[model samples]
Every structure is written in structure tokens, then in C-alpha cells.
Target: MPVVLQAGSFGRIRLIYVLVQYVDETPKFGHTAVDSSSGTPILNSSAAGVSPPTPAFTPSHYSHIYGSTPETLTTIDAPKNYGHAPWPRISPREACLLRYFIEELSRWFDLTDPHNNFATSIPQRARSNPILLDAILAASARHFSTLPSDQKAHIMSHYGLSPLPSHIHDSNSELSITEETVIHYHSRCIAELRVLANEPHAVMDEDLLAAVVVLRFFEELDNPFTSPPTETALHGLHVFLRAQASSALLVPGPRQASFWIGFRQEFNLAFSQQRNTNLPLEITDSYLIFTGAEDHVWTNRLVVLGARVLEFSYGSSPSNDLEFNELVRLRDEWVDKRPRSFAPIYTESPDMDTAFPKIWYTDDSHITAAQTLLLINILLLAYSPSIPRIGPSRRQTLESIDAQIRTIVLEICGMALSNRQSRPAGLTACIAINLCADRFTDPQEQRALMGLVVGTTRDSNYWPTKEAERRLRGIWGWDGDDD
Candidate 1:
């Protein structure tokens, strides 16, 4: 007769006893293993098969999460006469770089939000698709290419590779190496995705899109190009995303990835030629088809608005006082009517007595909320409205605008300060705060702002934070040169 396993009255694990005969002729002696979750098998005392000379199924780690596993998302047999390489083939050194990337890069990748973590999802997708795997490996290499000398040295040791000298440092050698790998993987992704692109309907080619997004990030984090294609990256990214958008437009499936790309393209605009903001038509279409989730929808709307401000302020779009008023009004309305789930962060108890060091990490609502506030701040601070020759100089308008910005900055600083060094939104908030650092208006507020930026640098040591320090210093004329 066989016995069944059961949970105890108080939900404690029941003792699982198995009869066993050992080589030492001991009866009922066996190795014990804990069952922490459902369906996992137990360990037996004997090295081979315990009690019986037969073996049963072992515990499996590859449980399906997406209803069913598709053949496309798995390892495949190499063809005898394939036109292209059947799988991604990397040298031993490149494999070492891949290992370094998998461990360190994933941490910062999801520093802000754990929802839909790209760190995990990208690698998992790679498991099923060799092209995606190559792309991720390439991405990780790109990240590796940017690390400081000591960090890269640690990576070399961690991944069992030869440590290079700090003098041969990350001037451009590593970047060049990674760029070759990226171009290689990108070429492969393009080939694979090009085949899928013409399928008349939207293909669920998330891995490819993800690779593009990652590559875009690599470009954004890039140091001043020893190479060209800063402009080319923007153009290629826009064109590929536009193609994806066209597919989504023709066939209505889950277009969340397209929406994601639109947001990315808008963010990428910060570094692009502002006058060239005539984006693809598909970005708008994707947003239109987006189901209205209050927080995300409005935030993306703000992204479009900020892009418009940039477009109009520059020579790209024709602008007037009415257009400027409309953009300001839209931002104001969004600020006023944000949803409860993502309401703007504020100082509670008048002194921020109740807030944590980084409330956004504790409160899910504040993450996107801070982002919206920051985008609005950036739009107002960075771009002029292009109002042609107004009477009274719009002095009152400027003062009012300054006041609105002042309040938002202090509030964000309060949240960031409360959240301290470990806050998720600190980098995001600090970036915007640095852009608007000139409007802080008071000496103490400026000091607090300085402290926040410095503390963030000490704690997180992100490249953007270092840039923010430079920007903040420039705002106060602490640096002799104007940025």
C-alpha cells in the first residue's frame, strides 16, 4: 500500500517517513528533505533508489507560466544545411562576459520598478530564442564595456577571466569590443525579425523589441562617441519601432510592447535633435489603442506633451501663445486630476514626519507620480513656450510658472530626502531636480538640493547621478563653465 502526504492542522509540514535499507544494513534510516512548496519531490536516504530498486521522477524547475510553451521559445536542433547559424555561438571570453552581465546588470536594470522586470524577462526570453539570447548577451557586454576599472576587474575575477590593468582602462577599447558584439547580435535580430515583420499581422516578437530597447539604453548611457551613429542609432531605432507599430496597427493584439517602445522613443528624444521630433504615426496609434489605465496612460500623455513642448519650442512645429497655454493647461489638468492609485507625493504632517526615505519604493503609487511631476517640471524649465512678442512681457506668467515649479521641486525633494540614498525614484527625481535647480529660489532649499544630489552619488554612484551633480553645480554657477 502507498501512503499520501498531508499538511498538519496548523499548516505545518507533516513528517514524511520512508522505509529504507542501507548498505550498512540499517532499517528505516533515510535522508530528509524539506518540501517548501507544492509538487516538489522529497530526497531519499540511499544514493541510488531508496527502499525500492526503482526510481521515480525528479523535481522539475521548468514549470510553464505563460499557459503553454511555444516551440519558438526553446532550444532547437541545428540543421545540417542551414543558411544561417542555428544558435548563438560565442567564444569562451564572450561567455565570461555574458556571465558577468547576468549577475551585475540585472540589479540596476530594475532599480526603479520590479513590475515586468526586464532583468529576468530578457534572459528568460533568450532561453527560448537564440537571437534574443545573443542580443541579451550583447546588451550585457555593452553594460560590461562601461564599468569602472575596479568594477570590471571584479567582473574578470568573478567570471574566471584574466584581469586587465586599470591603465588599459575603459577609454574605448571595451566599448569597441562590446559594440562589435552588439552589431553582430543586432544584425542577427534584424534578420530574424525581418522575416517576422512582413507577416501581415502583429507577431509576438517581444524578444526582438526588448533587444532594441536594451540597445537604445546602451546608446543613451554611452560616453561621447569616439564613433559616429549617435544620430544613426536614433534613426534606426525610430524606423524599426515604426515598422513594429505598423504591424500592431494592422492586427489588434496585445500592443503593450509597442506602447512601451513609444515611451522609450519619447525618452530618447531628450538626447536627440529636438527639431527632428516628427515621430512615426504608429506611436500615436499605439497610444490611442492603449486601454486607459489611469497612472500609466496619463504619464505617457505627459511624455507626448513634453515632446510637443520640445518640438514646438524648437523650429519643428509652428507655435503660438494659444498653443503654449493649451500645453500648460493640459499639464495643469493632469496634475489636478491624477488618479488615487498614483496620486502626487506630498509632505505629510507638514514636516514630512510620516514619509519614508523613499516613499516611492514603499508606496507603489509614487513611482509614476514622481515621473509625471518631473516631466512637467522638465518641460516648463527646459523649453520656452515660443510665445511671439507678448505685451507686459508676461512677467506675471513667468513668476507664476516659477512658483508652480518651486512647489513641485520642494515636494519631490522632501520625498527623495525622506527616502534617502536607497530610494528608487531618487535618480529620476534628482535628474529633473537638477534640470530645474535654478528655480529652487531659496538658499536653504538649494543647499538641501545639493545635499540630496551628493548623497545619491555617494550611495548609488550611477552615471546619471554624476551628470546631475554637474548640472546642479552649473545651475548655481559653482562651475566656471556653462553647460
Candidate 2:
């Protein structure tokens, strides 16, 4: 008889491993006898009156024990080759299972997808799979390399790629270059083309090339790898060529005229604002400097340019011959008003012949004293019409006045120096005398005239005389006469 083991008889049986078997005979439950004390199997279930120990009713016994015979197991439960289980082969089903596992694991691990794919559409499991990622990249490179050169080039251009010659020669090498590297190389090419476009001798076709390069550059501007080109760089290139042509014109060369024409054309285009304003003097000055035209002649030209600017902006005319003459006249009038003589001291009311003469002043008291002021005044006069007009040919009249006053001052100084009797006169006296002196004159009479200007005094009126003497002393660097 076969014995049956009850479910609760064995304390919860844990399944360590499972082996399935198939039966050739009617599946009779069997048991084997074991040494009771030692718990050793001493007898087989096939022995007389000893049937296989009744199989347990547990799920593990049904799955492992009943299918124990190798041949029977092969028929009932297909045997798996534990030594050579196929791996690294992920079917679509397996992929889905893997992705699901990842999603569940990510939740448990608190990992997140930066692309938010997990929150939106499920990512293709192959995309997230490491083994699939390498396969995809390799396959992409192979497909791209298989394309015809022209087609490849077109595609690359669209994507702003510039594959190196070596990359083209070797498909493996192309794999090394990434989208970012391609963009960087293309940007460098565009920058180089922009520089070439500004070269005066750059081929006409180069413009087309530069345009293409710029187009590529613009396309890639949105790429994180490509920095946007600056407007200043473009404008600077255009301006640089114009300046180069202008510089060539300043040199003695056969291309001078042609260069200048080109320069002006380019300049007008590049600086339309200045051209529209008729090229103001400041702009002209800047142009000259940019063209490296630094010379004294250029300096003078700039001054003339400034004058022209003043005329243009302020509605003043450039100085003419008549205006120049007027400047001279103004300068002379300023010189002629200087005093040449000081009053003399008298002991008594002098006799008529010897009485102190009246002091006369010239129009100008000193030489070169009013020169700078005169120049500034001339500049003002030339520029400012509000200043009173002096004469008939307003110009000639001002000039004549200037000359007359200047002559008077020169004459006074001459006489004062000629008549000097004691000490040399102070600056005011010298200036005054020089203004009054004769143009042809002697130094002695000039000095004598200066001393007379010092004046005579009477002792009886000592206080007033002293006061006057003190004043004169201040002028002449002297102490007043003592009692």
C-alpha cells in the first residue's frame, strides 16, 4: 500500500530548488525507507512491501518529485540547459518587460528621467537599454557613411556639419565626430570666410562662398555648440576694406584713383549716416585718421576742416582777405592806448617854458601784450557778426584803425625811451613811451619822455606830492621822496 503524507505534517516546506520529472508508468506515489535513528535512506521503494514514500501534496513535490525521471521529464516538462541559457537576446516582449521593470525600479530608487519621457510617452525600451544604445549608434554611423558623397554633404550642410577629410575617408573616424564637434568646425569655417570676404583681392566667387558659409552659420546659431556671430565683426570687416583702399590712395601709386573711388563707394555704403549728412568735418577727421594720414599738412587741413564745419553748421563764412586785414587793425588799436609818460615833480609853479607837460598815452602800452588777445578777438570777429562793424569796406576800415593805433603806440614807446634822464622806466612807462616814440627813433628821447611822465612836484605841497610819489613808487619799484 502507498502511504499519503498530509499537508500540515511537514512544517512549512520551503522550495530550495525544483526539478521536474515525467512518469513512464501510472504515477503511483512512492517512498523510500530511511534508518530511523540516523535518518539515512537504506532501502529503495522498489523492494518487496516497501513502496516509494507517499508523495507530499505540496506544490513543490508535484513540480519536483513526480517529474524526476530524466526521459519522462523530457516529455512532460521540456528540460532547460542550465549551462547554456541564452542571454543578451532581448525580444520586443522582453524589452517591454525590461522597461516596465526599470520604471518600477526607478520609482523604488527615487531616480528620475531628465527628458520627462517617463512623465509623457514611454521611451522606446531599446533607447534606454545600454546594449541597444551602442547598436543604434553604430548602425546610424554605418547608414550615414553609406550615403553618396554629395548627398552626405547636403545632409551635413543642412545639419551644419563639416566632416574632416579623414572622417570621410574612414567611416569609423566619422563615428568619433559628434554633432557638437561638427558645429564648432563649421562656425570656425564661417568666421574664416567672413575675414576673407573683406580682403580687397579676395576673388569675386569668394563672396558667394562667404554667403554660403554665413547661411550655414546662421542655421547653427540655435545650436548650443555654436556661438552667435557679432554684428560688430561683420561691420568691422566692411569698414576695414574701405580703410585699406583709402590708405592705398594716400600713397604714390598707379592704383590711387581707382582705390579712392572704391574706398568712397564702400565708405558711403558702410556709413550712410555720415554720407546723408554730407560728411561732416568730424567724420572727415576720423576718416583721415583711420587712413593713417597723420602729418602737419593733415593737421592744418583738420583746422581748415573745423573752420568749414563752423561755416556749415553755424552759417559763418571762412575768413577772406578783407577779414584778415581787419584782424591786423584790431590788433594795432589794442596796442596804441598805453601811457608813455609820468607827471614830473615841481619845486614851484614852473615858468611857462619849464612847466610839467601833459602826459599822453599811446593806443597800446606794450609790444606783444595784446597779440594773443588780438588773435582771439580776430577769431571772434571772423565768427561773430554781432560785434560792431568798424568801417566802410567794413574790412578795410577795421584794418586802417588797427594800423593807426599800432603806429601811435610804437611811436610813444620810442620817445619815452629816448628821453630817459635818470633810471630806466617801468613796464608801463616803457610801453607808453614806445607807443608814442617816432617809428625811426632814438633810445635817449624815449627814456627822457618816460622820466617826464614821472612828473614834477613842489615841496610846499608835500603831502599831496608824497601821496602821488607813493603811487608812482608803487609803479616804479621805489620809495617816495623823504622830507
Candidate 3:
């Protein structure tokens, strides 16, 4: 019997797996229909007419395309083998928008822009299922709403931005996203989840997985001050999607694999929310190498460390010398193993136009690198003050913590300079800077950091920047400068 990706089992999606080549543009899907011989046993929706047991979550395991080792993680209700889905009809307007995502939005997201394309299955699933189609349109609308109109034409020019029905202009010619629009599209996208409840296998579909993942991405789009985690605000939705993603060894195609690799970004965000949301999904060792690049590899490690920081902070996990020492070791190892290529590049061009270094960490991987550094700094800062009796003279340790924090805060502020476009991850640095502001008696550097955060908020329209700025203002007791 030919093998099929069985997503219904609440299985671990493998980090290390085979990459499937999606055939050329307009290519026919080459895989044969599911002819399951013996695979994971199906779970009955209820045992003796009562609700089935809540499966134990095994986060240590990974999803695999070949081996079934990670299959033991969890067992959710599953539809019979080779089951067919009820293909619901989503609007053509929405369908066209999904294409916009596939042809254009994908370029920005794992598309790596122009030269690269990931989530190849994103296109394949359009006609096959409404769940993915609605998801694409919903995310497309949200993304379009967030983009600065001036940047939209250039970023989405591949499909000729002029007169495209999706374009909606506002007073300042910026893409206008109304609260009503957000609710409408968000509902459209989220409604699909109801369909997947019965078909646990459907939730694991690659295109469906992509839909839910991007939907979570939209959660961060908010006012920062008042709105808290809109995309992630829904506890049950994020939990269910991740539960299924864990079981997926691979989404339908290799192009989609990159999306899963980068899943750590959203994963950490959900787990680190101030409310202390319980572990939604497990992080496996396989995910540590999402991108073959060293920067991505390093970033992945920092992501894991950040998770530990949150867990420790919330008292969900114990803080001991061993964990503390391991974190310190990881930090040093990351630095010691830094490749020459990734050696920080600081070019003080004689040209007056250049304000910051032409390149920071390395070409192409700057955001990921900067994010890694921010995570490391945040993790270290989280551990610095409360050294759980990890081999230290108390006075000396306090002194060292102060000194190290100063250095980290400076590096984090420097990171703001490289954030010319005001990328979303830049928000992380600003938040870290705000946290360390109280340590400095002089408000000058703290004030400068506040400026960067404020500037990024205006330029990027990335909401988290505003949250960081608001926190700083509160800390400094600043008055009515809501401008």
C-alpha cells in the first residue's frame, strides 16, 4: 500500500524529513490516492458513548515522513482511511484573493521574495477545499490592510497592483483596515475550523495547516495598548490547530515545509503571552534547523531558550542551577561558533547618507539574526537577576548582572538602528529595551530607545512597537503625547 500523510492522529510533525518537489506551474499533483494499508490506529470519538480521553501530549517527539516513531505522541479521533471532504463553496471574490496570496503574498512570506517560493501546496489546495481557500483570503485581506499603501504597489506588483478589486484606499492613501473588515474576514477564515473538527485528518492538510498558521500570524496585528493578542486571543482555536500540526510529519509539499520551520515564531509568541497560556504544542529537536542557514539554526536555538525563559518566569517549570548553566553554555556556544560570514558587519561609509551599517549580521538573514540576538538578550536578562544559586558569590553576581545587562541593552538598542524598514521582529528588541530601562539612572539612553520604538511604530505600523512604547511611557510617567 502506498503511504499517505495521516494528520488525524495528533502526531508529531518531523523537523527532519524528505522534501517533496511540487511539479511546475499548472502541474498535475503526482501522488496517488490514499490507499492505506496498516497505519496508526484510529481513535473512537467516544469510548462506550462518552467523550474520548484527552490524549497525553508528547512534545519531545517530532513528525517524520518515513518513520512512525513520533506517532506515539497523541491520539485524536480520526476519519476512516482515504476519507473525502465536503468541499464547501467560498466566494469567487475570496477565491481570487487566495490566488493573490499564492501569487503575491507567498512571495513575502517564506516566498523569500522574488527568488524563492515556499508553501507550494498553497496553490494546489484551492479547488480541493474551502477551509484553505477561506484561510488564504482572510489572511490576504488582513495583510493588505496592514501594508502601507505606498509599499503595497511595489511589494505586490507581480500581479499589477493597479485597479485590483482587493485594493481599498483610505484618507492618506494607505491600505485601510477597518475593525469591521477584520471581523468579517477573520470570521470567514475561522469558520473553517468547525469543518475540521470532525475530520481530524482535514486539520492536518498542508493547505489547511498553512491557513491556520497564517491566521495566527494575523493575531499580532493590533493597537498594542488596548488590543492584546487578537490573533492569538482565541485560546481554543490556536490549541486545536497546533495539536493537529504536531501530528503532521510534513505538510503536502516541500515548499510548505519552510512555513512549518518558521512556525517557532508564532509558537513562541503564543506561549510567551503575559496571561501564561499553557503549552499549546511541543517543540521538537528536529525544528532546530528550520533553515539550512546558520543564522536560522542559531535563531531556532534562541527560540527554544525563550520558551524556557517564559516557562521559568511563570513558575510552570523549576529554575535550577543545571538549567541556568545550560542556558549560559548555549549563549557562549552560539558566540564561539559564529561563522566568519555571520561576523557582525559594521560599515561606517564616509558617505553622509548612511546612518547605520550597510549590513548587520549578514545579507538576507538579518531579521532572523537580529531576532536571535534579541531572544538571547531577553533570555539572559530574564535569568540575570534571579540566579537560582548557580555557582556564585552573591555580591559579585549582582555586579556582573548589572554589567551584562548594560551591554545587552546597548546591543539591543543598536539593533533598532538596523531596523530601517521596521520589521515586526524589531518589536522584540524594543520590548527588551523597555524592560531594561529602569536599570539606568540616566534617562537619556532610555529616552533614545523610546524614540526608536516610537519611530518604528509609525514607520512599520507593526502594533507591538506601540506596546513597547506605551510601556516605556508608563515607566517614565510621561503625559498625554498620544500623537
Q: What overall lDDT goes with each candidate model?
A: 0.48, 0.30, 0.48
The window of 10 residues in a row where model 2 has the poorest summed lDDT is 9-18
Which lDDT tens digits does candidate 1 get at residues 1-483? 122212111112111111221111111224433211112232322322323323332222123555555454456432233233321233454456555555665544443333434545556555455445555655666666555667767767766667557666332333233444554444443343433434433223555555556555555454321123354234444544555655544542223443344454445345233343545533563442324554545555555565655655664444466777776776677666666656435435334332223343345334544655565555555455542247786776677677777667666666666555334345555655655667765655666677766666455443345555665676676755322
lDDT, residue 458, model 2: 19
Tell me each candidate's TM-score.
Answer: 0.56, 0.14, 0.62
Please write out the lDDT profile of model 2 over residues 398-444, one tens digit for every residue: 55555544444443333333333211112223323222233213334
Compared with the true structure, the alpha-carbon lDDT of candidate 2 equals 0.30
Per-residue lDDT, model 3, residue 400, is 71
User: Candidate 1 at 90: error in angstroms?
Assistant: 6.8
Over 76-170, each residue of candidate 3 has an lDDT whose tens digit, in order, gives 43322343432233233343455556665564355122223333655565555544554565667766666665655555454444433345444
Show model 1 residue runs off by greater than 4 Å: 1-117, 128-131, 142-206, 224-229, 248-255, 258-262, 271-278, 281-298, 315-338, 344-366, 377-393, 410-424, 440-461, 464-475, 479-483
All models, RMSD in angstroms? 19.2, 44.8, 17.4
Task: Look at candidate 3 and tell me the lDDT of residue 195.
Answer: 32
User: How does model 1 score by TM-score?
Assistant: 0.56
**Deviation from native of the Cα of residue 209 in model 2, angstroms:** 26
In candidate 2 the C-alpha lDDT for residue 356 amounts to 25
Q: What is the lDDT of residue 173 in candidate 1?
A: 36
